[model samples]
Target: MNNVRSKICGITRVEDALAAARAGADAIGLVFYAKSPRAVNVQQARAIVQALPPFVTTVGLFVDASRCEVGEILDALPLDLLQFHGDETPAQCEGHGRPWIKALRVRPGDDLEAACQEYVGARALLLDAYVAGVPGGTGQSFDWSLIPARLSKPVVLAGGLSPDNVAEAIAQVKPWAVDVSGGVEQAKGIKDAQKIDAFLRAVRGA
Candidate 1:
């Protein structure tokens, strides 16, 4: 089986971040959007980032945030990657001096190839479920069949992923990586250790 990387997103505490790293997650996401229940302040994010051991990627997630806000967070945190989860223009995603990925909420009749082409400079594209007025962390699955068999860039599958269904998701999507937030959470912003472990095991088993 191909190694499918796992990212534990919506990290708010140092302990949770450490737990994820200890569980062998490839990356941990820190939510920067204030509206998100998992959102963290600069101090929280900084502490979590500092607590992490070497080689574990730290990703900062934002939703339609201004350049100034993003810059401020970048100055405070040593995020390894940026994940834009809003309707950000391709040009807006560039020139940040950091590799970034654009998240697209998949819906029926959506032309994914064209969308990927628009964000050609992205390091990868993350696919998530679309809910009215909800940005992400919806914990709702989309139609996996909506994804194309081929793409110009790598794909990171997200949305409604848990240990139970992650193996099936991997089999179908064959994404480069899988991102999960609410799936392993005991509540909003609180991660469950057993769930995290099971999620990793499922990815490996797949």
Candidate 2:
């Protein structure tokens, strides 16, 4: 079986980004959402990107941001992927000339198959926990049984995953990738090297 990939989201500092990379994270996420405690500006993003080693995908995350705003960030640095963590339609997510993924908060009564069909153009689908009015970064997990056995696109499981439970999550969900933000953090935007290492180790062991 192919080892599940990992993405360390909401990376702020160059050190944290390096820590994740050294720990064998396939990707690191940089939040562009202003309201997020982990949000990073063009300068911060650039610095983090520049300090990283080769072959590490840099993902730019946004939450209901304007097209212009996203464009400006893309214009500033090289974000290998875009993560739309808000209510962006397929049409709106398109035209960026870059590969993108849609984050859907899993709530009861939601049709995930329809969402997969809706964002058919996405490279993958990210499933997160649903918190009323909160887009993501909720340390609380949702029902894993909610995910279907099959979908049109690859699934990148998120929501409250940590070192202790990631093995079980990967074994159960069997997602294409796993995303973590607050799980490995020492603070809101600061990552603990030990936690990051342990998280990656757990994913590998899983």
Error of 1 at 194 (Å): 0.6
Colliding residue pairs in candidate 2: none
RMSD of each: 0.7, 0.8
The global C-alpha lDDT for each of the candidates, from Candidate 1 onward, is: 0.94, 0.95
Pairs with steric clashes in candidate 1: none
Tens digit of per-residue lDDT, candidate 1, span 1-206:
56999999999988889889999999999999999999999999999999899999999999999999999999888899999999999988887879999999999999999988899999999999999899999999999999999988899999999999999999999999999999999999999989999999999999
* Count of clashes, each model: 0, 0
Candidate 2 structure quality by residue, lDDT tens digits, 7-111: 999999999999999999999999999999999999999999999999999999999989999999999999999999999999889999899999999988889
Off by over 4 Å in 1: none
TM-score, candidate number 2: 0.98
